[model samples]
Target: MKKLFIILILTGLIYVTYLNKEIFYKYPEAVRYTLKNSNELQRAEFEKVLKYFNKEEDNLKLKCAQVLISNIPLYSYKKEPETFNQVVDSIHALKNKLIIYSDSLKYNKRMLKKVQDLFVDKMNFLCKTNDFFDKEEVRDIDTLSSSFLIENINLAFEAHYKLPKKYRTNFNDFCNYVLPYRNDREPLEFQKRRELYEKYSWVYDSIKIKPLEDIVIQIYDDLKINIDFKKLSNLNLSPTPSQIEKLQYGLCRDVTNYFVLLFRSLGFAAGTDYITTYGNRHSPIGHNWFFIMYDDTFLPIQARSKSLIFSDIEKIFKLTNMPKVYRNVFNKINFKNSSINIDTDVTNMYRPTSTVQIENIFQTSNKEDFKLCVFNKKSNWFEVDKNFKLNNNKVTFNNVGRGIAYAVTNSFLEPINYPFYLDYKGNLMFLKNKNLKEDIPFNITRKYPPIDLPNKWKIDRIKALNNCKLQGSNYLDENSFKDIYTIKNFCSTQKSQFLFKKEEKYRYYRLIAEEVTSYTSYIAEFALINTDLEPIKNVKIDFYGTKESKLKQKSKITDNDPLTFGRFLNMKITFEVENNQNVSGFEIQARNDDNHINIGEEYELKVFDKAWKRVRKEKAKDTVLNYKSLAKDGLYILHNLTKGKEETVFTFDENGNQFWFGVSDVNDLGVGAPMSMGFK
Candidate 1:
């Protein structure tokens, strides 16, 4: 009788196990396979998470089971038993956290429904594509990956539980929009990248202990302290937490990624908002900043302590031409037509005004109906307004609020990549005439050789001559002159003025770069002026420099000149001289001080051979040091032995023989230049 009873009990136990096979099955082989590949930290973390899940309530486990069974479909996992089991375990682990956190808030049913809907929507997007996976049986592996689903689940629960009670109903439906992990790059398996975030859990824990406002402040402070902003190569690869922590430096995008991931790991809603490029010509690159949901309001957090105002963000960054601004989200945005390729990852913009006009549509017909779709970041693309229709292949989207949006036809869609900001007048202004003549003003300043001239070198007339016919090998020869207009004496003071006689046409003009010095003549700011004394519009003015002066040659500047001023050493203007223009008057200003010092009573001058081996020292008798007897290419030094001031001047004489002046100081004590010696 005892043996018969034991046999019956064993049969009953086996029947119960077989009946609930999906929930009871454990893959010892898969566990061992994962353990063999994982490192000590990964194994420890996985076991820790598994243990936590094992402690969850029976009801929570059943809820997870029901969710997977209803949405995942048994047919989807028929062939991939190992992937199915792993996914089931990961989901259970995630749900365990959700139940624990939700229990603290007494479990709102409305929020729970919203969370489930988000999970289903995200899962659908992930499972829709099989291109990333190789095996047919495991095609849905990406959706099941712990990094994708479980991480998102964790985020959804945190957003719902921590969201203020007032916003519970209005925001409950969109909680999942802030949960997914898709960035600028394509969707990737989170399982492989989970270990990276786990390494930085300590950072999340530190912030989690603080109050809401304190938490935000702590996050900003911690990031500022830890991450240094440095551009890195191989930006295509999204960096792991360990990599970012070790490198300690990254670009704006890389740093923003780090900030978002760090916040998301701790269950805080964070994302990046950026301009593709600045509208203002002053800035050539785009900019990105952290956007955090704080106190039920979206605020832009910068590296500084002060909070950034949305309107001022445009002005502060000098954004003039924002083609499209994008706010990043984690979930996939599905448009009405799959055939139309739109960049769905970009969903939010920072537009605060009505300046962005959507125009220039190249459609088959102007009368065809079109819709402007704006992404809500939740799940669907909401239409802007029915009034926005295509008229003459254009439509102006005025006062368009901040979001990722596109203009679409039944069969086509075009993404608005840049977010346009309104000018002071509250109108979307196209960047037309970036090169308008009114924008650039006339500027004439002294050039080189003699950057400063003595006040005594006075000339009666400065000529505006043009229509040059060049003499052989010399454009400034006496034969090159065709027409010359000599104005009365104006080159006496530092600033001089001249007026062009009425109705003069000129292809070339000449102006003094510097006053006549013993060594060379320097010139700059040669321009063709209009009757209003403004620079003539759009004329290519070519500049040439030479040691020779046109005054001595009794000729005009030539067109085929070879010598051009080095941009770094001197400023040269290059505008085409406008013909048949009359100048009211023109002004020329010399440099404040001649870069070349007069040596007069300041210091004693010395000359050395090119090698600096042979030295010829001389005492300055007057303000100026005469170098007529010195060899060309000689090294020169200025010494104020009394004041312990000594420096080597690097200048060469023309033709191996000429006087050179000191322009700047030098030091030979440490690396290359000379240094100062304190007076004893």
Candidate 2:
């Protein structure tokens, strides 16, 4: 009788444990969505759970379950919706953390025992929590990995502040305080109070900017910091601190930091500011210098050089007013000595680099390669052959070779540190004319510890994929690497994905597809990306004009949604540009026509480089006009190309990607020169 009783107790414990695994993850999503105002919703959700558990009846449980299932939708209907989304996200993150924790429980005796305790604690308390969404509404990743992930709203800023004092302060001014609690602490408040004592007591009491002394040296003389720039450059290197102190030959950041440390030791507060170093690579290598605040004034301190100096803070801010980006910009703030190599893992920042900028660039002697080009922010030409004269912003090589050409402009010359993003929708949606930062998230599965009772799986949500083709296949699959968005399969479903890169610019592009797919019917959809900034009107586009086939027709990209569709074709589709500056990309969905598309994949053979002549002008390039360019915003009439439809507004897909072709446009940026391609 005793043995039987023990066996039954164990069985009951196993069943309860198996049934409650999903509850832990469901909570995190709710927490994430409510992060902005956790104080209000957190308690409400808890109360709901308390009420749910004590109802004590089958009818109550059924009613509660129904209520839970509807919670996610109800939150959607509420105002201040962004707050709710964060809750769901946080819950998802926690689930991943829990999973990691659980994995260790199996491998390491010490960690395993600790994890088991956590699971029991979590399970016991979670079921009692409120059912704001579904019984399993919050789960995201496994429970173990999110151990260090910060979920609360303050978590973002607080985590940043926790970095060593050096990193905390080295960040841009925007992240100085982390969570932007400075509505009342605007910088203009100081600028406005420059001279009044009685009217602004608080402002008067504030610490004012101070000045720093410049120690200049004669050309013949040298200080400890005055080292030669040449002595400290090469493949992956940095000058030692002893060298910096001994020679006083420091780069922008080194000199600035030396002065900052000096000021701090003198009982005064001083800090260094960084900016980008241009010309070495196409990317900007960040640089910084020191500043001191004293006697209600701020001044720049360049410890090594005497020729250039910043006299005041107000002036300094105006000179370097770069728009704050979401990623770390500090990586560029080094001097001749600071190194930002990926091997060092300084910032863990990885960006796609092109061979186009490789030194000893390939040159072509063949005159057939005549084409236009763009170099950094400048434009010029190169004489590739007797008749083929090409001009571009100054780079190397008076001649060129084929395959792919790499040209490094001033932008890539410097070391640039920024988060990667894909905004290829190309001005077609709310995200149109907008680029959002995208991080490659891990693919997830339902390896959650098996519960005794069977629980059905479901897709919580899904997002679309980008339609642009980057260098190599982007995703793990390699070929159709371009994906717009991703979601974890909480419940596995046997379905294939249609993948492509999102593009805003409209231009000539190609789709290379392999394999075949069979589905219920035959229909197709295509995404039209216009890289221009104007509205698109009626335009006729053709299909399957590959280097083969009967491919020509008409189509439109309506404002409502850019996913335009067409019938089946054995080959490719081609379209004309209208109502935009220029277009770079398009998408196609083929149904019913197995020859046109398969169930799983399609390839877009892209023509990345091309040349153009403004329709308004004869044969001259877009920016080099016959007369002065337009500075003020106005209509740019296309006088030539009388072949296409009479009234079509050609536009590209973004705010910055295209500027006026007119020379004197207010924004100095103009259309780019044509790129070289084809058999020379």
**Candidate 1, RMSD to the unseen true structure:** 26.8
- Encode model 1's per-residue lDDT on 1-680: one tens digit a residue: 99999999999899888864533234233333343445565444433333334544533322222232222211122132233324334443554566687676664434444443443344345455563222334222213433344444554455445544432322322432344443343223355235534554554445445544555565455433232222222212233343344333345665666666555455456677775443211123456666666555665654432332344443332222333456654322221111212222232244333434465533334554444443222212234433355555566544343211233332233333221223333443221212223222221111122211111121211111111111111144434433333333333223233564554554544442222222223222233456676656655444444323434221222221112212111222223355445544444432222222233324444432211232334444533344434433333344444333213233332333222221111111111321121100
The clash number for model 1 is 28
Best-performing candidate as measured by lDDT: 1
- Where in model 1 is the C-alpha error above 4 Å? 1-148, 151-174, 181-214, 225-237, 282-284, 303-323, 333-351, 355-389, 398-422, 428-680
Write one digit per residue (lDDT tens) for candidate 2, span 1-680. 99999999999998877754444333334333322233454435533443344445533332322222222222211121232334334443554475576664453324333433443344334435444223222221111011112111123233333333322332223221232211110111111111211222232123232112422122112333442233322211122223234333434544554444333322233454433332111123345445544444434454444344434433223222121101222222121222321111111111111112122122332223333121121221111112122344222222221111122222222211110111111111111112332232211111111111011011111011112121222122324333232222212121223233444333323332221421111123344444442333344344442322223223322222213223232333333445443333333322211111112232111111112233232432322122222211121123223222111111121231112121112111111211110100
**Per-prediction TM-score, please?**
0.35, 0.21
lDDT of each: 0.37, 0.27
